[model samples]
Target: MPVSRTERLLNLLIALLNTRYGLGRGDLREKVYHDTSGNDVAFGRMFERDKNDLRRMGFEVETLTDTGWAEDDSTTTRYRIGKDSNRLPEVQFGPEEWTVLLLASQLWERAALGTAARSAVRKLQSSGSLAAVELPAGVQPRIKPAGQAFDDLVAAMHARHPVAFTYLAGSTGREELRTIEPWGLGSRFGQWYLMGYDRARQAPRHFRLSRFTSAVTTLDKDTYTPPPGFNIREELDTLPELPLRTAVVRVRKGRLLALRRRAADGKGVPPAPAEETDDGGYDTLGLPFRDPEVLAEEIASYGPDAVAVAPGELVAAVRRRLRAAAEFSASPKPRYEFPGAGAGARSTGKGTSEDQLQRMLQLVPFLVHNQGLRIEEVASHFGISRRQLESDLHILICSGLPGGYPDDLLDIQWEDGRVYISQDLDLTRPVRFTVEEASALLTGVETLRGLPGVAGGGALEAVALKLSAAAGEEGRRAAALSGPPVTPVTPAAADMHGTVRDAIAGGRQLRLTYLSPQRDSLTVRDVDPVRLYSQDDVWYFEAYCHLVQGTRNFRLDRVQELEPNGREVSATVPAAGGSPDRLFTPNNGDTTVTVQLTRQGRGLAEDYYAERVAELPDGGMVVDIRFGNTAWLPMFVAQHGGTARILAPDELGDAARHWIADALAKYDG
Candidate 1:
């Protein structure tokens, strides 16, 4: 009753074809091979089956005539679902639509879609039914979950129980274990959050799901109760009125037309008709969101064309931040002086390199005007190849004007095998880094240079030099390390890393001097090192230890020496499960859980196990959480000491009771 690999492969192809605008036979082969991790023969077989499967599923595939596919005696197909050609829906957006949706989800509010919705949209777009459509008003409502925490929350919500999680609060470096009842999830401001009743604090709390870690579900029934106390509908229904600060502005009717055009183009909202005002036919600009300082600054930026008429408060606030900024700017001694200004002063113009400026210009032109440049064109222009161009571009695109989203200042658009630029030119001036900035950048570059299989150490050194030049004298001060910094490689670590990595990747067995808990011992062992990772400031190799015939984690630091046995691993290994970094490892103990009831908790318990009959009252319900092993139970029970109580599972109950007794015994006087 389980899906076979071949079936999964066929399904994956079908899914891709269904959603894409259309895939030619050759295109399908390429994509399948690439996405399947270079399984060419497997891809071909799956591709062949996909055609047959499509016909069986009632899709009308159009065969392209006089195409290479026809020469090979293969049908060149384009998927069409409709039975009647006249009634056929159009194929819409292609990768462009996918990219736009991705960006819109990040930028605009609420653009999350179900997997099914994504598939449908992809299919419609790929079929060539849709073309170059941007979301209306440049905004669409979509939901983007924060991460796996949200996925777990969804599973718990379906299970209908109070969920316990360690939540990181805001920017604070602290975590708290809180139990909450389930509620609907929503996305806002590019982050997913869960709003629910907090039982411990007895308040309505909202948590950003991204910061949630180590989530666990409680089996306790009737533990959560939603009070009629908070009326969500009433809260949402109240729309606050926007307070306005009035401002006066004179516009030549033509200039007024330009202002309207700019505003409409920026916001996709048409401005109202220009009307005559008391002072020589000036128009009134009533700005919303009463930050007078901001309004004044904005008006000032309009130069003499705009003037603030009333509500002097707005004007004053704008002057405050700006005046402060101006004062701060003027107070600083000049970094460089104009050549004629002073004999001893440093050069005043911020020295940005010609190459840096050209790079900045290239990014904007390629992303916006070119819709994205051809990889070949970029390579040719830079005197490099496509791969090198892409690598450099990715690094540049990632760096931006400091601080937050939309701050990225650059975007790439890919269309017709070319890239176009989206944002304005950045890095026009040479980048200057302070002592702190230069050292930080240098440290990053140094670490990256030490990474295995990474190339172009020269490029990293160049970036570091640019940063250093930007910092001038200040960068030198920041680079001065108080204590020796922990470098990534000290020649020793590099050699070890190289040897270990090569051995693992090559599937060769190793003989290592392993330090166990008891003592250091020389042992001969064979392992299929599945993954290499660093945990808690120590490097570890997770491998299939042949001695135990199971997975084990061996500390790299504890490794006294490693020698290759030159014997290749013969048996295959199963694909590892989820990234161990994000998932919990089974601890050497049992965990105990208890049930406590609030209206919401009870609702959750029922939801979790609706099919399993349970005893309940008219208003409350009961659920149970049991652990077969009692080792971890005591600690679990102690964390939620107030709400949870050990019941039934007598062994865990006894363990919890014994733990409490031991704690009290220690303090007994």
Candidate 2:
């Protein structure tokens, strides 16, 4: 018999044991060799090899003594797992959970270890615990093939080989053949990216796997060396294509504030209102401010309020697109005829409208007060179809407000067709930011509130308010307060922060407008944004700057422009390992410190330190902190004066002493 036949016999034995609760030797032989009656002919060296294979594959087939299969009364010859050998835990499955499991298992089919997931399913089938569970036929999921390139790429990644391929740039439709030293694979925002070192550029880059045309793996493994001082996270944020020149156009009233907020905070903000300029023109916006075409639809939505404020070429592009849209909408819309309908509006069946409304009303009492309820149960209770229930829900979301929103009495959180409701909502309580929270909000908003493909000021403010209310009274109050006045020059520090955060989270590179005091010069550099931190009331981007050829800190206030670089970054760039200590360069010779922070500054320390607490004697906190760069400490001490002191790094102590002496000398003068 072939090896496949022998494997099937073992599977057959397990299945028979599960079905009969225990199988006799006669039954096992009959099932294993259906052609032979009462005959065990397949017992040879080949059979021993099959048994050994089964053992190697984690099965516990062994001799048992309880069945009385042996001639002697005291001995029995049977094969089964020993009672103590069942190390696998029993798991019970439900219909829905089982369906999900089956769907997830399909993902393994595309992987190199596809056989393992199938084996797992086979074992589950043999386990009597899952015997009663049946997944419905309608729940069968549609499986899409993962394409040849993705499979080949994944295999190459696992094999640790260099792959040369023609990669399609999704945005450009351009193909380039390049060799890459693969590092890792990650999925972000519904797209797959292959991280590796690009031999052509000799830098770390990430390529979208879906865009690769043809790829072949070479036998060479680990031949590539990542560029020295390269950081992958930093490289991700500084893609060249991602750094577009973004222009934010705020609306009337808090428009400038919103624009500043959007510029300062870089996560996407809600779309700006459609604006009409004095000349009946419109303003357009997008992230990285590089491509206006991507946000053409958004600009069109504003009707006319949107204005282009930067990069003359982008403004012209928006105008040209607007002209094209104007010409397109000028064409008449085509109409379709139904099978039996005349030109007039369709009529509802007799008495159907009242019945539908009554059914919807029945759902209101339960749905209005509850956060969530099952769609299936609700559909059954109301004698309604799923389609009808969904249509009613759409109407309900817009129904409650006295006029529109604030007075709206209800809201819904629809998840997988399940409805969650928030009732008796007060609209007048617009999302408010507290002084400190507003400070943080303004900090976040200034950078992010205006970009396309992101949430804007109005949306952010509402979300912030919702979060604040959920956080309780103190948070609400704290959010209500505003921060002290300090003017950051054009484009604002807040905008830089938002862009950097977006770039990091989006896995795109960043191009920053940096200003150095050496000369009043604006330098554009690509960087991977790794992390953001604030010290002494100032925000800075700790990114791997391609210009400096290393990781460096760039002050938010000094940044001129921050945009997403959509191009691939090298994945072979070594990650900035260790801790935040990596931020301090060797030439700087910065050190970590332990500090006693007064009650006020303790909160500040808590924000930065993972481990921070107040010690009793002085009502201050003992905090361990890393000052990657020491120059900022004196300014920090001066700003939050009386509440903070340097607790460690005796070198910092000497610096403080010198600073105090300088101050005393001024008094002597």
Candidate 3:
């Protein structure tokens, strides 16, 4: 039988790696490609593609053009895979550095970075340089989740590909198509920003993640490499802050409380009776803002309860948004990527041959270092099933040097139930960093520098330095990845993160000073922590609230104080009914409200977890959204300004109309 492509590639890798003088094209054709290719043109094409594939996999394939095979022709290039250049240079890490590195790797719990961080950590572990004890109590931290756009940008950047997206510019408040050569992505002040050379503008520009109106897409792979010695941070710093502007607003009493919290100096036009509202009273306040569009969205969410009193531009913005919202007719809506949608979806697929080959390359060195590990343990480490592991192992057993001999092929056996690699075929060390792997670790480590109360910060810096040196170009791609403040990394809420995580791990109860948005009040409560997770970049922890005597999800941002209450488990609440994936699920008590949503309001279906959604021909959506507390429905309707309308339960629509009438009344006066 003709040699399998995988075997041929392996033979090529072994031949190139073991060579000292660099193998010429003629030699590779004769030794590695003997059974695979006969035609000279075909062999040359295969050799070139394979060489490029090796480079993409992070191997340093050096070419010497001057040294040809026959003394007659000096132009034929000789290729050699330099072991020293491809492999990670030896490094010593104290336990503390390893702990910090572990924490850094844990930053991206979901999306692209999460996979990257995990794989990166495994590679580092294979190096035998990771000597880490479990992080001490009160030391664990978590990363805020990134959106789909963030994930796509990191992927495109690592692949050295250009990307295109529909971006809603903050300045113009207009959605436009933008194609860019992405350089770096990072957070400046609790918001994610992408720094890239805009192809349309032919200049470097920074775009925010929230402003992404559509999905990010990659253009062509290897479109153009970043300029040499480019730094992601240096590029990010060039983005200037948005100019500060303020808007004065009149708010009806007991309404628009969140807006009240952002008031300037707590002293404004003061309380006054209003003829425009059904409300008996109103408060006039001055609100400071940066972007008009953002402010308009916020004000519109209040419906007519809050109105712009001054600044003709601010008034115009609010009027325009409300008009657009009102004018938006219901059409079809795109689906949302809800958390944990499919059941047992992760275990079904066996990967392609190319994917398996890549994993085996990493698996060899890992097995070599971590000997006698259970088959299940190995499968878990590589994120595969036992059957797939067996398949890979059997294939590995058949792989070796070009020659077919007992000694030439690898010696691997699992019949005894404990895997042992008698021979690794010189694949005893992890292969060099794939761009994705290097970028993940680099981005995670950089995010560590921003985390508050993290010990061994210098160790993190040192780890980043080593990764950058080893990863080279891949490291720069990682530097381009950034995110908002993970939870409360500031001084005050720093320790609370570890405390919550520690409580969950140690099974201890917690005391919290949490601000509830619905109740519009702060309360001290004791609770048994269940789990911690994030969505849309916000952190939340499910805990059994003692004050309410029920399980509740608390927003980490609104948490003022959190500490262990010195109480043990009450055993009243089970962790789960088979440990479900989502933190919260819709209960029977939630009321279904039918709403007409325009294209701008489609996000609401996802936010509220619509029970059912039907697309409208006009690019709008009719969704049956669930809400436990319909009291906030009016505000929800108002926030979309007018893009959302209550189609059923006539009472909610009346409430929203009244709220808007009250706010619009301010401008009338």
Winner by lDDT = 3
TM-score of each: 0.26, 0.28, 0.72
- Model 1: lowest-lDDT 10 consecutive positions: 104-113
Worst lDDT 10-window in candidate 3: 341-350
Q: What lDDT would candidate 1 get against the real structure? A: 0.41
Compute the lDDT for candidate 2: 0.44
Cα error, residue 200 of model 2, in Å, equals 74
Q: What digit string (tens of lDDT, one per residue) describes model 2 on residues 1-669?
A: 322342343333233323313444554444443335323344434334545544433345664556535533222444554332422233344443343333323323222223223333323322332323333211111112233344455446534567887765545645688788875443332234567878889886788654554434454545544334333334434544444355554232222333333455555534444344433232332333334444433333332234454444444444443443333223232222222323111111122332333333335544653445678766654445677688777655544421334443346667986787665232111111112222232222222323222322355455444334433432332221121112222455656656666665555788877775323366899988766544323456667778877777777877767788785445734443312322233334446665555433444443333233334343344555655567545434432323455555766645544443333232233
For model 3, how does the per-residue alpha-carbon lDDT over 47-164 read when each residue is reduced to its tens digit?
7788877776667788776633653352476878877777765555677677767766666555556666777777777756347555533333445443446666777887778999
User: Per-residue error at 34 for model 2, in Å?
Assistant: 70
Model 3 CA RMSD to the hidden true structure, in angstroms: 7.0
